[model samples]
Target: MATLEIDLFTARSDNFGVLLHDPETGRTASIDAPEQAPILAALERRGWTLTDIFTTHHHQDHVEANMALKDRFGVTIVGPGSEADRIPGIDTSVGDGDSFDFAGHRVEVIETPGHTAGHICFYLPEDKLLFSADTLFALGCGRLFERPAEVMWPSLLKLRALPADTTVYFGHEYTLSNARFAVTIDPDNAALTARAQAIETLRAKGRPTAPTLLADEIATNPFLRADDPAIRAHLGMEAAEDWQVFAEIRARKDRF
Candidate 1:
């Protein structure tokens, strides 16, 4: 079987709203709505009406445009059940272990409550694609906002356990900035150097460094390498908890 066609829309500057389509069944759904104009324009360009909107969290950047777009397109809004109260206009509330169909594709909702108490990432096992909100980023993870570092660590581990082939579509285009910080701590990481160079090249051309594969991330991303001996040693801490490393990395990024 071939992978389902996933079209990415770079809406609201750095935020990305994805479109999942299955030509066989002619079904299409969008992942999130950070802004209204760009998502509407993308849908119009493809002549596709928004059938469903899956929100990862209640962050304004992720769900602010939900009502405007829903009213404009008559779309079904789905969001994390744990955060239904915060996610405005959610018609269907989902939780961990829940599954839904989109264009003949089955998507599993993975509860990742670190970026937010209700943050949930949609995972398509068949396609090995994870619409990881702000929980897991290219070179870093989202800041510990409403939750503590310990609470966020397990959430990110859930994502790291997925198949390495999963294509991670994150919420922001903060790669270059994050990579710069990663190199400072893991200066000997040849992969990080290479990826930084590539990212620099891509950004210089005004290109997007998105839809990055999880496999590449595992090899190069420091946030996902808390267990690595090299990283543990560099942190000047032994027997450190996963969240400790996560905290260190996030703290560094904040200062960087």
Candidate 2:
């Protein structure tokens, strides 16, 4: 099997559009279609025909160009089963724990329902890559729009359990702001301090800070550090349940 080739590009302000291709089979898939123009240009540039679309949720920005792209390419659309009726061009619906093959690669669907009630993430184990969408981000997690922090925390824990080296590809380019907020919550964390400085340099250059390593997130992301003694102590929730600690951190971020 040939290694998967991934192309990451900007679309619709801060949204990141991704294309995944299997070089051996010449099969390609777009992670989300925030808009049609850039995605089309990307495909044209690579000369890769889009065979499928893997949507993470029903958010308009995430699925706005679904129909246009599908019409243009006649591609297969796959998305969360819970939001099948809501997604614009869904053809195949999958839920948590479901496994499907994409050009000989096994993709696992993980139901992550915090950002939205039907949000899902795609994990390709062989490649150690996870398309987290809006559920998780670098140094931050999605706002609880449709679910409570308690519900969202468990969803994050599931992702945390993946191998430390798994590369996480999230939906937006919110790292710079997220890093700033992370420092406020984890003021004493030396690792976070250094990470924030690095993010500043990247943003200064107008570069992308996504596809972050899971290990770095676990080490520096406050949302993923609710179990860490230092973070729990800073929140004065050392004796509180992990969920309680998570809730406090999320509430603080909301106000930050």
Candidate 3:
């Protein structure tokens, strides 16, 4: 009955480093290696040895410590197959709809390409945990760097379809800024206003705002509410498609 042990810690200026350990099988994986020192220190403190690195994308900030930790522990590196050529030292290439086992738990790979053309998310249904990387954030989605809002909206739907109880761990600590922007677009939402106020307190206390519950994000995150009538009215896109609303929101955020 032992469950997965997740070690969440801060690394670099805004990155979060997550280590997943299975007590039953003694397997450990770093969701994405943001920095070498922090990953190693977290493992050292937990007394867990690294056996795998499940990479979410080709971004340097996410994969910077891949080789360093791999060389240190000889851990296997798993990454997106579509970006295999770009990912450094990828030993396993997995794609969208592909899944694999991690210490008896099923790891579902979802291709979310707006943040990066090959950015992926790892969802563990049994544990209700999602390593969202840079795809979906607390109150905002990742900037449309590699794809347009049309493509990103569908990618987000893949996550929004997940169980409400799922606990999400994202790549960066961008919640406070995201919250600031969210209140502007979803001003009429009581849930969002309250959540934004709480984010202010959380950041003031220097607490991490990540590992947010999917249910909370669904209720308050404007990015996930493009189909909601209130937000559509706010943007004067009452009859527009969901992605169009999403595009307007993204553009506003970029300018904000």
Off by over 4 Å in 2: none
Per-residue CA lDDT of model 3 for 1-256, tens digit only, reads 4699999999999999999999999999999898999998999999999999999999999989998888889999999999998887899999999999999999999999898898999999999999998999899889999999999999999999999999999999999999999999989999999999999999999999989999999999999999999999999999999999999999999999
* Ten residues in sequence with the least summed lDDT for candidate 3: 1-10
Q: Which stretches of candidate 3 lie over 4 Å from their true place?
A: none
**Distance from true position, residue 67, model 3, in Å?**
0.7
The alpha-carbon deviation from the true structure for residue 137 of candidate 1, after best TM-score superposition, in angstroms, is 1.4
RMSD of each: 1.4, 0.9, 0.8
All candidates' lDDT scores?
0.84, 0.93, 0.94
Query: What TM-score would every model get versus the actual structure?
Result: 0.95, 0.98, 0.98
Q: Which stretches in model 1 have alpha-carbon errors above 4 Å?
A: 1-3
Candidate 1 per-residue C-alpha lDDT over 1-256 given as tens digits, one digit per residue, 9 for 90 to 100: 4356777778776887788767666566788889988877877787777778989999999998889978877888889998999987899999999998877678999998877888999999988889997988888788878888788888888888899989899888898898888888788889999999899888899888888999888888888887778887888856887778878877887789
Better of 1 and 2 by lDDT: 2
Candidate 3's TM-score reads: 0.98
